[model samples]
Target: MRTVVYLVIGVFFGIVLFKSEAASWFRIYEMFQFGSFHMYGIIGSAVGLGIVIVQFIKRYKVRSFFGDKIVILSKEKSFYRYMIGGIIFGLGWALAGACPGPMFVLLGAGYLPIVIVIIASILGTFLYGLFRDKLPH
Candidate 1:
């Protein structure tokens, strides 16, 4: 029952991504190139909403849908580690023209070539997990 509900939610999110053109490579390219504001507007709105929700969660002691307490943890700040990670992520996004989330959506939308991107993402994640302890915190 829970699995079905989660699947439904995931499908709905994929549909929204498709409808919003958030999964479009062209939109991503435009965002990186500053060719248009459409994608940026979408990203900004999501960030604003996220900030509001996070604040509310912190202030109101929000619980999960399943009744567990929500916990937000603070991590130690590392400037150089974060900068390097961000640069690599940005370069991957520009080159692939899709982030991890939307890459799945693209695969579901029948863009078969995105399989390579998805596979590469999975391998990258696996490698990260294997080497995470060796990396800077």
Candidate 2:
């Protein structure tokens, strides 16, 4: 079933995150402190791969398995809005010691304390959805 496939893929991704120590709080701390380049290398590689994937998708007109076209939306450019959002996100990441993706991985890895971060993330997302229309474009 599709759900099973999705679960398998997610588990595989979590394993990769764990193996690469991308889900490690110490690695994230080191990144912020400039104490090590390990996490930076991983993040940089991911960004590079993402750029290539985006280009490939655009060039090849990639479609979903369900036959739907994959559309990437272009948003209005707003410097202040981006700066504010990035500041908030960075603060949350620093405080929680984990971003959303790695927070879930940490939870799966038996860090029960990550539930607080997960709940806060969900609440933050909900609040954003409620207020996004009222915010600047």
Candidate 3:
């Protein structure tokens, strides 16, 4: 039941992403080219929708899909750690030109280069897990 709902939502978004050409590395790269507005528009729409949904959740105390209140973790308030993590994330994104979600899509689209990004992302995640408790904030 819950799995079916998840699968359906996933498949729906997968189809939308595929049909919109959002899963293509070339399309994503072209978006950074200043001349193309397609990618920018897609991203803008996503951001706008996310903002609206977040506002609704904040205002209404909406139950999440899992029937629980969505937890926003803010216990870790160390600015330095967050800054370092953000810098690392930005550097990886800039170098790879694809985020984790898009990297999988790129791989499916026959972009072999994304394998490096996937490997690095996995390694980063493993390293973070190894040190998260020990790391300050």
Candidate 4:
């Protein structure tokens, strides 16, 4: 089943996150504190790979599993808007000790305290959705 495949893939991704220490709060703290390059290396590698993958997809006209055309949207060039968003995201990451993606991974890896982060993240998302239409584009 497609659901089973997705589940297995997610579990494998979580294992990778755990093995790479990307889900470690200490690693995240080190990143925020300039204590280590471990997390940065991981993130940089991911971003680099993402660039390559997107290029490949665009060149080859890749599609989703169900065959929808893949499209990479152009980023907005508003510097102040992006700066404000990044600052908000960075502050949350610092306070929570992990970003949104790793919150689920950390929770799955037996860090029960991540539940609070997960809940807050969900609430934040809900509030964002509620105000999305009213916010500036």
Q: Pairs clashing in candidate 1?
A: none
Candidates sorted on lDDT, descending: 2, 1, 4, 3
Best by lDDT: 2
Q: Model 4 RMSD to the real structure?
A: 1.7
TM-score (C-alpha) between model 4 and the true structure = 0.90
Backbone clashes in model 2? 0
For model 4 the local lDDT of residue 126 reads 93
Expressed as tens digits, the lDDT of each residue in 1-137 for candidate 2 is 77987899899999999899999999999999999999999999999999999999999999977788999877889999999999999999999999888898999999999998999899999999999999977
For candidate 4, write residues 70-137 as lDDT tens digits: 99988869777688779988999999988987888988878899899899989988998898788775
- At residue 91, candidate 1 shows an lDDT of 91
Error of 4 at 88 (Å): 1.2
Model 1: ten consecutive residues of lowest lDDT: 1-10
Misplaced by over 4 Å in model 4 are 65-68
What is the Cα-based lDDT of residue 5 in candidate 4? 76
Each candidate's clash count = 0, 0, 0, 0
lDDT values, one for every candidate: 0.91, 0.93, 0.79, 0.89
Candidate 3 stretches with Cα past 4 Å from truth are 73-83, 109-113, 133-137
- lDDT score, candidate 2, position 133: 94
Worst 10 residues of 4 by lDDT: 76-85
How big is the positional error of residue 86 in model 2, measured in Å on the Cα after superposition? 0.8
